[model samples]
Target: MKLSRILKEVKINSIYRTGAKTIKKGGFRKNSNYDPDISSLHYRAQDVQPGGLFVAIPGLFADGHDFIDQARMRGALAIVSQKPVQSDHSVTENISQTKAKQIKNDLTVIEVDNSRKTLAMISAAFFQNPSEKLNIIGITGTNGKTTTAYLIESILSAAGLKTGVIGTINYRYLGKVFENPVTTPESLDLQKILDTMQKEGVTHVVLEVSSHAIDLFRVENCFIDTGVFTNLTQDHLDYHGDMDSYWFCKKRLFTEYLPSGRKKDRAVAVINRENAKGRELFEILPVRGISTGNSADNMIRPKKIEHGLNGIAGNVLTPSGSFDFKSPLVGKHNIENILSAIGAGIALDLSLDHIKAGIENLFYIPGRLERIAGNNGCFVYVDYAHTPDALSNVLGSLKAISQKKIICVFGCGGDRDK
Candidate 1:
């Protein structure tokens, strides 16, 4: 695509063309495009190139603005910054007059209100707006995001849609699966993944939206078709500063990003009414909220639940209809995960039977209530529960099923104030 197209799509404030600084062929000196065409989108200065777009995003430890000189030296043709550049930003600024002039001639700096948001918009545009081509479902909460994401993926696939998933476990679509260090990837990687998914015939994507990702603007413009709120609890307080701030961050998914699209109905929200914050979010959701919980009047609820070590069996009731919900995954806490996924299915307008098929087919999810053999018929299970509420739910569910005394062993991660 042309440089004008990328800038036009984002409507950036300014674009200044600089002189060409040539590089050795097949080496670092190989000059990138002298003009507006961009070969890539990057946030870090180290990754910038002559034709690459470098977004100066402010971070907690280091600020990209401080590394403008490196980006310029690395041949960054287009720079996205929140403010105008200063001559002292680059070490090249103090270089010999000839080198400094050539550096100046080779740079094009664009300023914007928010460089992070700009990176998202430009990344999506650079990837040819791939999110718009797929049905994206975003799940947010302190817990249950990964489980609900798995459930939704299975449901979409059962409906004959090729589904890709972006969650805590990994970002997977089509036949490829790769480890993801973060719950939600930054805009450039996210847009690139969605672009690949679209090309591979993936019709749906499920994303786990973490509070950190939301607050940092990582999920800025990858418009969500459906947003599901599993529940919120005491978590990430240090980073968020308070419970209110934490809830506010999670609320952004329903209130802002979820509603941006041509079809208002497609931008549906699935929330857990049992959660105080979830209920609060439901009221503010841009679309008609699909509230799921034990409440009789909720849009989606479980009429009857039967839990055992084998699995959970329940009659799931939704606005579309009611069906028998069965899953091999254990724990009563997972009931909330199931309900949230059911709401997602309802939002997708999937038939109740398809939802049932999807839920029952998922036999297990790794490191989540995974059962292992123990001596003398004793049972052992592994889980990834860190928060107080999450641990309580897991232990409580296990106690309910086992008549024998239950012993608990857990520890918080290093440096977690909670």
Candidate 2:
């Protein structure tokens, strides 16, 4: 792809020619003669290859601008930075004058107002905007995002649409799975994965969007068709500082990103009406809202629910129709997850039969109330509930179903909110 094409939508402050001389004063011009063929896009200096574009991000721990010289040494043709690349003498201070001049002469540095947002736009452009080619369902919140994403994926798969998933456990499509280091990947990796999924004929994708990813502009260019808000709780306060700041980050998925999606005209928000923050988000959403909960006023709710050690069986009432569903997933919290998935199914115009089959087919999600055989007729279950609210919900569910005394064991990690 040409540099001009990759930066077509990027907001530029200035474009610097070889030797750090100013070429264009503002933005990019389609008819400009400085368009170079870009082979790839990378943020890490070590990953830069010949003819690649490197984006310098000012991260929390380390600033990528410090490695501009390394990127140039690795044969990067272009550099994108929020700060003035020429004004930073630290990048060339250690090198000999001849080598420093060569480095500058071989580079085309473009200054942008925000490198994070620019990286997203250029990545989407470089990959031909794969999100637009697929129906992306973004699930955001604190506790139930992973399970809700799995349910949505199962439902979409039951509808006979080839699907992919990017979530807490892993990223998988067509029998290929990649380890997930974060709930949401960086923009470059995300676009590349979506592009691969699109080429493999995936029609829909279910993504678990994290607050950190949203705030960092990782999902800024994703065209979400359905945005699902499961529920928010007291978690990640170490990073977000307060509940309000965390809520604002999660709300951006629907308010800021969803409205600019490819299916913006049909974009829908599947909200957990039982949650106070979710209810507030539903009221302020710019697109259509599909409320899900046990409340009578919810658009998607459970008509009758039965919970036991074996699993949960219930009839879910939705705008499309009522469907009897059974799942090996236990707990009242999973009821909210089921309703959210059903609402997502309806938003995508899926048949109730498909939704029912999808719900019943998924037997388990790892570490989410996973049952284990125990000695002396004891039942042991493992769950990944770390927050106070999540732990309370798990214990509450167990209390409701178990007649015998229940023993609970848990621990907290370091560097997290107490």
Candidate 3:
């Protein structure tokens, strides 16, 4: 893509051409007008290809700005940075001064105030803003995001729509599954994946939105059609510092991001009314809000529910209609997940039958209270419940169903908030 087109939505401070002095003024060069054709975008110096644009991101571990010469040596045509580009350095001091000067003279550097945000905007523009073309459901909270996302994905798939999912387990679409390194990927990788999904005819996408992703501008320009707030609990306090900051980060999904989605008229917030934080979020949502929980006042709730070791069966009541839903997912906590998914389905204008089928079709979600058959009538379950609230819910559910004693084994990771 042309450099100008790639940076269409980016907040550019100034653009400097080859051999051009760093202008003090904050604007494009009027005299030196050259928009280089960028082959690709890269944050790491090692990934830069010939004619690629390198974005220097200031990170906690290492700064990308320090490796600008390496990116240039790898034939990066343009450079994007928050700091002023230094033209005097080579990839190493071993290189002669003449070679360094020649390399600097052939490069184009674009300065911006925030490189991370700029990367997101430029990536969206370069990828033609793929999130805008598809209905995207963003699930955020301390827990239940993965299960809720799986439920929503199943519903969308039942509607005969091609679906894509990005979450903690994996990113899968069109029979392809990629391991997920993080709950939410960086903006460039995310945009590229969404673009590929759009090209493959995916009509709906479900994303697990993390607080870190929101705070770091990873999902900056992605248009979210439906935003689901499962529930906020005391988790990730180590990264966020406090409950208020964490809540604020989650609130941005509804208040700031949802308004800019393609389905502006149809944008909806699915909130867990049972949760105190979720209840507060529902009242302040700018878009249409669908309250979901076990309460009668909730827009989506499960009635005549039965929970057992086999699974959960219930009649889900939604604004559109009521339907009988069955799932292999056990526990009372899953009831909230199902309600959130039901609300998301309703917000997306799906039929009750489709939602019912979707809920029933999913037999299991990996590591979310997965049941394993054991010898001598014993039952073993493996679950990814790291937080105190999550563990409490899982153990509470086991205690409720167990005829005998329940043995629990768990380990906590080092350097995280307990």
Candidate 4:
């Protein structure tokens, strides 16, 4: 976009113009009112190029400002930063038409109070505000985010909405899937993905928002139409340092970011109230709260769940009505997952028939209770249970169905609290 349009309502802290000394008069636009064309935007200096804008974000380890010379080497058209970056940007031999004509000696540098927040907002502006075109659902908690996201996408898609998903496993849309290294991507990548989804006519997006993503400002400014809190457990204490701090980060999805005052009937917090933390959320959540569990009044309830190592079959009772729900997903914990999915379906205004169809239709979840068989008459299940709560649940389920001795093997990370 034209630099003028990009900066038009964007709040900036300061401005620094650094480059070869091409200035003849006032601001960079003094000579040419036509804004410099910014072809692409990035947060890392390594990704900067001739016509790109680089955002210098201060991180835990290496700070981005330290790499200004590297970005300038690749012809960074503009640099947005929080810390003062005093770089003597040497002249480049090859330059874009806009840069050659608009800037003679210096590069455009816009300083912002908060680079991370500005990166998110600027990305939205550059991408033409894609989140506005899609109904985004942000799911957060210690576990079940990936499974809940898969279940939500399935149900929403069955209801005739073109749905996309961003989860621990992958980011998928329109029959295409991309490998994801994190539960939520950085702000720039996220905006780009949402923009792509909007272009492909995707109407709904389900994202598994991680606590680190929230704390690190990775998901800033992205609109979440609905938020789901699966449940909180003791995990990520190393990063958050305490259970309260960790829970506080997850609560942002429901209390701070979710769309407010839309409708109390259309609940925002889809929670498993059976969990103590989830039950606490049900009491404080503002817009809407849809409880899911075996409780008498859970809007979506799992009654008499019949589950084993092979598969799960159960009765799902929602306020809209009850229906038979079954899934190849193993363990009783999956029953709560089913209830969470059903609650999401209800919140999205989907019919009971579609909800039941979506849950029963999904036969597998990769790396999550995935089953493997051997010819030697033994069964094996692969589960991504890294924390104490998750390991206990998986082992408990396996032991419940084993006719012989149940053996378990697990490990903890080197630096993490065990």
Candidate 5:
């Protein structure tokens, strides 16, 4: 696609303006009509392609205005700055904090109120909106987004669909894996991953949409076919400051911006009914929703729940009827994850039988109730349950089968949940 088309689609209304010193330095594009061969939807100097549009997003820690010089030096043909316009200001003065605030008026920067949201819009435009071409499922919550995302990916893959996944563990597509530190990568990386999946013929994608991602508007323009709320708990309080704010952040995936060109009713919401916040999220859904829980009212309800040494067994009651499934995914929390996956399968038009088959076929998911072997008859399971809700579930699940004392050795992070 052409540079103008990318900018036009993303509503970026500005042209390339080489800085005076940059023009004097000679590597910059002098002409306003000069278009770049490649463009980026983010501000990362490293990720900037030659002739890319660097999105200079100002954050609490540092102003993107500080990095504009570096980006310009690295062949950034244009920049989309998120600075406010001030009436009484001048661009001729040296670039200072005071001066940058003032120059927002006459600069040819594509100014946006929210840079994070703009990045999502630009990424979607650059990637030709790849999320629309695939069945994208977003799993969000304080906990279980990673587990549930991986679980859904496993179930989908077992059903013979070429699926890709993006979560806390990694970004994966057709056996190719890349480590991901952020639970959700920035919008441009996500778009590139989806674009790769699209090229690799991946039909479905299961992505873990974190609250940070939601608050940052990282997925503002992505089309999510189904949004699943696993379970919310006290987490990311350091970032959001309060439970209300955290919940509001997670709610973005289900409530605020969703992809365009799809039927309004097509964006189905799948929620965990056992969780109070998840149940509350269901009420906010404009479209009819499918809920999963261990209780009666849930569309995907678990019955005859039993835990064993190896795994857990349960009969899930779907819209069609009840069916039995046994998975290596232990703990009641994992049962909830199973239900979330079942809800996703049903949303995708798969029958109860196919869903059951898919569930049973998944025997492994790293770090979610993962069993470690030892010489004795003792059972040791490892999990990614740093949050209070997840900790209680893991310990409580083990306590059900524990004849002796159930000792829980744990430690909380210093900076988080403070």
Candidate 6:
């Protein structure tokens, strides 16, 4: 496809340059015009492939202008850059692109006010609206997004559909999983994952939608099918500065980012009825919502909460009826987790039996109430509860059943949310 063809489907400001003979002239092009078969669009020069447009975004610490020459050198069909336009001959000699072939590729560069948002839009067009074809579940809140996403993936997979999950712990697909250090990856990585999931016949993809992901527009233009709110607590103060901003950041999942006017019947929201923030989010959902909590007063309630030194048992109350189950996971917090899972299962039209089986089958949650063995009858647990509410819930649950003193040994990170 020609550059003119892509511009017709999506708006294009300018075409600064196009196909060159070699990397020195501009960059590598499989041919002359853009490739219609390209899998995805990317911003970083390093991620560029044949015919992909390399968006030169000005980052916080490093300006993307510095990498434009490199992206072109590496084979960017076009450059979406923020740097004040310098004549092609004026590229500073100080920056070297020896690895990008000879001289930096003098490809076409599109100037834009906000390239990040532009990248997202171009990606949506390139992917032929893949997000619309599948159920994209976005789980937000200070805590439990990852766990909730994991539970969603497990429940979906247990019901016999290939499920994909992207969160702090890892990005999962089929039976294979990759360790992901970030709660949410960049937009390009995210779009790539969505594309792969769609290609592999995945029916559902659960993503841990972080406050940062929302703020940076990493999930821009990708419609969410269902959004789940776990609970909001005192976290990310360093990034958000205050609870109000933090709450607003998490709220974007439902209020601002949900797909607009797309048959509200297909969209659903599952909220933690116990959390005030969750209630606020529930009020904003476009369609009818499901509420989950251990309290009997909850709309989608979890009853008969029983926890011991061994495991936890509970019954989930749905519009249909209640289904009892046992979970190897312990704590009232875990019960909250189960309730959220049940709500999601119902939202997706899964059977109570399948939901119960999925919840019960999940015995391990890494670094989350993760227990360790010892010689004596004593127990040691390692958890990733970095927030006040998380610590309170875990400690509160253990305190309820302890025959002896329940002592907590903990410390905060050096430069993190202390």
Indicate which candidate wins on TM-score: 2
Q: On a 0 to 100 scale, what is the lDDT of residue 34 in model 4?
A: 31
lDDT of 2 by residue, 223-302 (tens): 89999999989988888899889999989998988887667898999999889999999999899999998889999989
In model 3, which residue pairs have backbone atoms overlapping below 3 Å?
A: none
What is candidate 4's local distance difference test score? 0.79
In model 2, which runs have C-alpha deviations exceeding 4 angstroms? 18-33, 87-105
Clashing pairs in 5: none
Each model's RMSD to truth, in Å? 5.0, 2.0, 2.4, 4.6, 5.1, 4.4
Clashes of each: 10, 0, 0, 6, 0, 4
Which scores greater on TM-score, model 2 or model 3? Answer: 2
Write model 6 residue lDDT over 1-418, tens digit each, in one string: 3444433444444444433333222322556543333433667767777666777666757766677666666666666655444544223444434543464445555655677777776666566556777788888887787677777777887798778888998988887788787888877677767888899888788988888888887888677878888999888777788888888888777766764524345778889978887877777776668888756667678677788767788666888688888877767787777788788898888888788878877887888887789567887788888778888988998888778777688877744463
TM-score comparison, 4 vs 5, better candidate = 4
Query: Please, what is the TM-score per model?
Result: 0.90, 0.95, 0.94, 0.89, 0.88, 0.87
Whole-model lDDT, candidate 3?
A: 0.87
Clashing pairs in 1: 18-105, 19-105, 19-106, 23-29, 23-30, 24-29, 24-30, 49-75, 50-75, 69-90
**Lowest-sum lDDT 10-residue window in model 2:** 18-27
lDDT of 1 by residue, 23-114 (tens): 21111112434245678778998988676778888888988877776777787776788876644345224445665655653566676788
Q: Candidate 3, 184: how far from true, in Å?
A: 0.7
Better of 4 and 5 by lDDT: 4
Regions more than 4 Å wrong, model 1 = 9-11, 17-35, 88-105, 263-265, 416-418
- Where model 3 places Cα greater than 4 Å from the true spot, the runs are 21-33, 89-105
Off by over 4 Å in 5: 11-42, 84-108, 258-263
